[model samples]
Target: MEGADWLRTRLTSLHCATCGRSYRDGQIRVRAQRDGLSFVDFVCRACGREANAIVTVVGRGRAARLEVGELAESPPGARSPSLGPADVLAMRRFLRRFNGDFRSLFGADGRAGGRLGA
Candidate 1:
């Protein structure tokens, strides 16, 4: 089968990262195709956001199979939380007199140096 056909079939069962809505066949559009590879775009009808994917077809005839190379960027809200102001302040305080010696900072006696409470 073609790369686009395989991708549409696979993507239809997956949900969008932003809106959590399953992708439909109509929502997928093939942007480019060459050899056994295709670049496709998915526009979510629910959130009206767009995502891109790279798909590849390996082998031939009955042995042909589809593989997803990469998907679009994940939703920003799903990322790990960033360090807060308090964390920055604590790091600054610890670095004030740090001699850049990791071994001494970590302590030779299994104790964290820099006055880090055990």
Candidate 2:
């Protein structure tokens, strides 16, 4: 199954961080995908506000770790193309070449270190 579909199957329910509106599995929608993660964003059916979800499955198959985090805002609009396997490999390559420059990796706000913008 695709990342989003897998996450949907795994999740029982979710709620909007901004509005406290509850969401069943079918209410969420994928806005982005990278690696074993899916970024889902939608207008809350209850409060009519935007909500974001970062659903990730680490490892593979049955041993994977499924994580879901609420985002204050939707993810950044597509900066480039949709993520793919090749993009993940390229990211791994980039990180491998990283010289541990914290500022360069995370930018001035250190937002890139986590889900700050989204």
Candidate 3:
């Protein structure tokens, strides 16, 4: 399968950040930008809030960055990127668990596909 197809399958199964609602697999919308970034959105079922998620695959170092909603933005008082080690760890875990999906999304030519920590 192509990268976009793989990414779409994985992203659509993610839970909505606002309401913790889990979307059906392959049902979520994914848009890829020219810069190689993927945007995923999910609306909270409880509060009707929308959460925007961004995923960027960096160079061949097998590094992937993820940001959720406005939390990724540096607010007026924030001095740096809002992500913490714990958050990074969580993202890593998620990626590791879903490495298959990512590999399909990015393709074998993109990077070595394996579990996140493997």
Candidate 4:
């Protein structure tokens, strides 16, 4: 497997420090990589908390060595990109207009592929 894929597997096995929830593969995003260093973001779906980390992978193939460091943890009871009253109101309006039918909401013509806000 590629170095990033291997690193993601390792991260997926770990739980979020704030929420204690196992991270899904989709929640682990590799933002950038160069040489032996990689920047990764781990976003917890349950609590909407994000943690930034740096991973180092040296060598290649089976002999590759992996190390992780410089993890930026959020302060206790802190949430990044805090939401405002306007955001809550906007969400309330959307939810009020939203029905349970996601297929129709996202356009069953396959343009949106069932993703919200597509």
**Most lDDT-accurate candidate:** 4
- Tens digit per residue, CA lDDT, model 1, 43-88: 7889877777887878777787677666695353543467999999
Off by over 4 Å in 3: 44-48, 58-118
In order, how many clashes per candidate? 0, 0, 1, 0
Q: Rate the local accuracy (lDDT) of all candidates.
A: 0.74, 0.68, 0.53, 0.78
How many pairs of residues collide in model 1? 0
Task: Write candidate 2's Cα lDDT for 1-118 as tens digits.
Answer: 3566667656545667677777667676776788767877655667656656688777787887767775656454522357899999998998898777777566667878533233
Per-model root-mean-square deviation over C-alphas: 10.3, 12.1, 18.9, 11.8
Q: Write the per-residue lDDT of candidate 4 for residues 1-118, one digit (tens) a residue.
A: 2566778877787678887999988999887888778888888899978788888886788887677775687454554467999999999998998778878667787577566555
Candidate 3 whole-model C-alpha lDDT, 0 to 1: 0.53
In model 1, state the lDDT of residue 99: 78
Candidate 3 clashes: the total is: 1
After superposition of all CA atoms, the RMSD between model 3 and the true structure is 18.9
Clashing pairs in model 4, backbone N/Cα/C closer than 3 A: none
Model 3 Cα shift for residue 90 (angstroms): 50
Worst 10 residues of 2 by lDDT: 72-81
The CA lDDT at 54 in model 3 is 73
- Report how far off residue 17 is in candidate 4 (Å): 1.0
What TM-score fits each model?
A: 0.52, 0.48, 0.37, 0.54
